[model samples]
Target chain A: DAGVTQSPTHLIKTRGQQVTLRCSPKSGHDTVSWYQQALGQGPQFIFQYYEEEERQRGNFPDRFSGHQFPNYSSELNVNALLLGDSALYLCASSLNGGVYGYTFGSGTRLTVV
Target chain B: GQQVMQIPQYQHVQEGEDFTTYCNSSTTLSNIQWYKQRPGGHPVFLIQLVKSGEVKKQKRLTFQFGEAKKNSSLHITATQTTDVGTYFCAGPYLSSNTGKLIFGQGTTLQVKP
Candidate 1:
């Protein structure tokens, strides 16, 4: 069975623009979470979605929002992105309520130029 | 705010040597998970420890959870070149409204042959 998958392995965006990254969770997984990882740093939690609703959120601003579809696929949207937004956007999927181990996608690298 | 920190920002070891990384949390955690990220790759789930003073092993890797539930460690015996990557420890911090997983700065390991 295929594991978690993310689209557009790499993306480049300009300041003030917007970008959307997609992720398809592992089969049978119900919860999806997003994280941002800067170079040489650990992944920072962005938010988590469960049952097609945002169950939890991190310290990210409203500029960073996300949606999880009924199929358990998720999309992370960034509005008026800034250079600081340049990082690796990672998608992680977990079973139940995210209290278990997570399967992560290769992540989408976003470069703001 | 809950936070996690890792020691020895980076380590370089020759193949067949041993290595260890420590993770500490500012607050108690219900569970802790570990992941490994290779250069230019996504983070992969390694293991999870829940009970305090718990210990588990996967082949050459040993995982431990502190008695206080606020610290963890990952130890690798006889490292190999294939083990080069950054190891991250993460745990969830529960709040009234939302719960988020916080990741440590990570321990980057370089295994040279």
Candidate 2:
């Protein structure tokens, strides 16, 4: 089965601009979550979506937002991007809140200049 | 906020040597999970430990959950070049059903052949 799929394997954006990254959850999964990973750092939780509604969020700023479609696809939007925003954005999917485990995508590398 | 901390931020060893990374959580975790991210790759699920003092093995890698449910460890026996990557330990923040995870800073391993 196809696992979680993310769009734009790599991207470059200017500071103060905006960016949108997309993700398609793995087949048979219903929940989607987003994470940010900097160089030499672990993935940090951003937010989670279930039933098209954001269920929980981490300590990210309001400039970071996300959406989950009815089909279980997700999009992460970052506004007013800064150089620090440059990192790998990962999308993970799970079945029934991921009590078992999570399936992660290849992730999108965002580079802000 | 809950936090997961890992020790020995980096490790380099010969292919025939062994390596282990430790993780500790500030709060009790319902379960702990292990993930491995190859260089320039997204994190992949390794395994999960739930019960207290639980242990699981996968090939040459072994995972352990302490009796207090707040610590974990990953050990590799006779590491190989393929084992070069960052290993992370994560725990669900509050409830497993929330789909929120707190991940450690990760332990990067380099295996020299």
Among these predicted structures, which one has the highest DockQ?
2
* DockQ per model, Cα: 0.63, 0.82
Query: Lowest summed-lDDT stretch of 10 residues in model 1 chain B?
Result: B92-101
Q: Scored by CA lDDT, what does every candidate get?
A: 0.90, 0.94
Best by lDDT: 2
lDDT of 1 by residue, B17-58 (tens): 999999998888888989998887888888888888999999
Residue-wise C-alpha lDDT for candidate 2, range A1-113, written one tens digit per residue = 33999999999999999999999999999999999999888899999999999999999999999999989999999999999999999999999888878999999999999
lDDT tens digits by residue: candidate 1, A1-113: 22999989999989999999999999999999999999988889899999889888888999999999989999999999899999999998988866668888989999998
Restricting to chain A, the TM-score for each candidate equals 0.96, 0.98
Please give each candidate's TM-score. Answer: 0.96, 0.97
**Which tens-of-lDDT digit does each residue in B1-113 have in candidate 2?**
78899999999999989999999999999999999998988889999899999999999999999999999999999999999999999999873645789999999999999
lDDT at residue B107 of model 1 (Cα atoms)? 96
Could you give the fnat of all candidates in order? 0.71, 0.83
lDDT of model number 1: 0.90
